[model samples]
Target: MTATRPLLDPAAARRRYVRVCVLFWLPLGLTIAPLVLLLTQRGLGLAAVAGLTAVHSLTAAALELPTGGLSDVLGRRAVLAAAGLLNLAALTLLALGTTPWPLALGMALMGAGRALSSGPAEAWYVDTVQVHGGPGADLRTGLARGSSATSAALAAGTLLGGALPWLLRLGPDLGAATSGRVLPLSVPLLLGAAVYVAFVLHALTALPEPPRPPATLRGVLRGVPGTVLDGLRLGGRDAVVRRVLLSAAAAGGALAALELLTPGRAAALTGASESGAVLFAGLACAGFVCAGLGSHLAPLTARVAGSGERAVLLALGAGACGLLLLGAAPTATGRFSVLLAATGYGLVYLGLGAAGPNQNDALHHRVSGAVRATALSVQSLALQLAGALAGLAVGLLPPGRLPWLLGGAALLSAALLWCRRAGHLAPPDVSSPAEAVRPGVRTDAGEGQRLL
Candidate 1:
């Protein structure tokens, strides 16, 4: 008989949560500030850069379901470690490559890594806690902490990545000696690769997977595809899951527009690439800090609003308002324009941060351990799909119109939440043909039907 694994207690859950936060977020944050700017600096145009980003999203979208299913079938630790390895290789390529095709290739690899890492850690945490504390385990507190930690990591990494290139300039002049071979902007990406190596090592050493049937190559091949199909059916058939997925897609569009437009705006406002990098970095840091604060406030927001759905509506509404402000900021003069842009940017992050845990909590309530990671992947696929479309659209449009378009979409997304409130909600239908074959281990309908 297979040996039963020991259950994870609260303290162990907390430890796993922290590890997930650090491993998943810190490396990504380290490269965010300079990623677009570095591409532009390396001679790609704005449209090309956007296309590269779309490629990343496309790659991630393609792999999201399969990778998630792989985690469910095999184990979270193994998949997470594999993601770290892919990321390390991708980061190295990003730092060293000098051409557009090479850069695009790196981004594609990074996307695969992203898809793999997306849900496994959180799945692991939820599975552990459920095994120990049962279905009623408090998830919001841990999820909130994880979200806040992610934001904090982004904040620190943005600040550091933004300043590192400028800081490197302070050292002895390498431009002349190296014949302009050493680009300061590439330093952070290389550093990020080192961090990725560390994360992989840490994941291997620290993350413990609950014992299950040892997965064979054949089993993995057969099981993963089946799990992916089941996950897709659940997402399509379940009302709450469907709503959350839609919300994620809307968020992706909003974020894609912001990311595509903001760096260029900062560069234009600052009037130089180096100064633009610094300006964008500082603004990104501030935005991430605001996001952390918003995540910290998620539970409180839910409490205040009397329901999670209402809180999502409020947060999305705030985000829409911020995007509208951003759309109008360019019309203003001097310092006011800068201030408005910063405020709008911060508010957008804040709203998204607040919405994240709430939506994930709702998702968690509907999915069981068997398909949890797969469900999260389905959500991620939606986000990446929307982001890819938004990136392509924003790339083709004039920068001035991008924010307005995204703001309208955000409003439409918020409007969706209003259509279903209070008692109108129903438990997910697990009786569908596909789900009946692989029924969810947990029936969350009892708590899921509750107001908040």
Candidate 2:
């Protein structure tokens, strides 16, 4: 039998939350890519950026199932501390090395750090928020807050990436060599290393970790397969989880394709002129700002989505339409298509951020620590795998031809989510409205008679 975890102390939750935002993730956004670009002088070229992203996603995919299990057995706070140290090591490497091999090594290490940090933080938040409200309506609200923090970090990081080097005049004056300007690239990583060290300290003394058995080599190997199996089982048994994962895979796949081919797509839209690249970058930046703003409005969008499942379905549906629009776009229509796609992306994230907690809280009600961690990792792995495949497919076709493929993928994603809701629209939990743990806990989906 699966026993639910108790809600933790609220004040502790707030401390951890604030620490994660300012210390860990924000610094990450500020650190890695821009500095690396300075060393490589690549200026957002496809191979360099895409390779970094692909390696990161692949590492996350490879580790997702096992890392979650590791957290389960070792404790979330310990793993997070280890992760902070690893992040420091990664940035340190980037500061000193510029070759593909060293940078690749650094990027891979960074991805490993991401694997360690991402899900655990969400798990921590879920555990913490459940304390005050019994995972009540506040669960979704908490996720919204997290999403807001992330968006804010992203916005700030993007600006810093553009501003930091020029602010220091570290560029051309640094004396460019055959390998480009090394000094400009070195600064961000060194600064980030210090920040990561702070994160390590915070994780150690500030965060509360539960007691667990000493980690064993044998247990880690045994736990991997077991945890993965548990995750598969949960998805197989639960219609909603299954839908979310499938939708995740499809959306992730499309997003991966977008990441790979967006430049080319933008160029094609803008008539492939000398200014096309700048236009594309600016336009995409604008779209990102819109997404950050959307995070602020997630509560309102949640209401618009009606119920959690419906919100997910609507997000998926909009993405499908956006994809088709891109595929069908012409000279005049392409601009409109990109705009729609951006809108779709922002709206979907809003729904996910708002409804994600509800789903997570439901899972907490359904399983134990190790199993819950494993389940979340399974979703992450599916997304990574989908993204990996989409990225690879980018090269199989001509650079400009990726729009249609993304469209088809989006359609498939929408259909899958719709099917998940068809089977089990779980009723809201009346017994513990405070800890609503049905399929989706936020909405008042009332009654045993919600009979699908």
State the local distance difference test value for candidate 1.
0.78
Q: What is residue 51's positional error in candidate 1, in angstroms?
A: 5.3
The sequence of per-residue lDDT tens digits that candidate 2 reaches over residues 99-186 is 6677678878888887777667666666555445552324555555666676666656655655566566744554345344356546
lDDT against true structure, model 2: 0.59
C-alpha lDDT score of every prediction, in listed order: 0.78, 0.59
Give the residue spans of candidate 2 off by over 4 A. 1-8, 11-15, 31-36, 42-55, 131-137, 170-172, 175-182, 213-225, 269-277, 280-284, 332-366, 398-402, 408-412, 419-452
Model 1 TM-score relative to the real fold: 0.87
Model 1, C-alpha of 424: deviation from truth (Å)? 10
lDDT of 1 at 316: 78
| Deviation (Å) of 412 in candidate 2 | 5.9
lDDT of 1 by residue, 109-227 (tens): 99999999889888888777766666556677678778898899888888788788879889877545666544788788888899888888877766665786888999999999989
RMSD of 2: 5.8
Clashing pairs in 2: 7-131
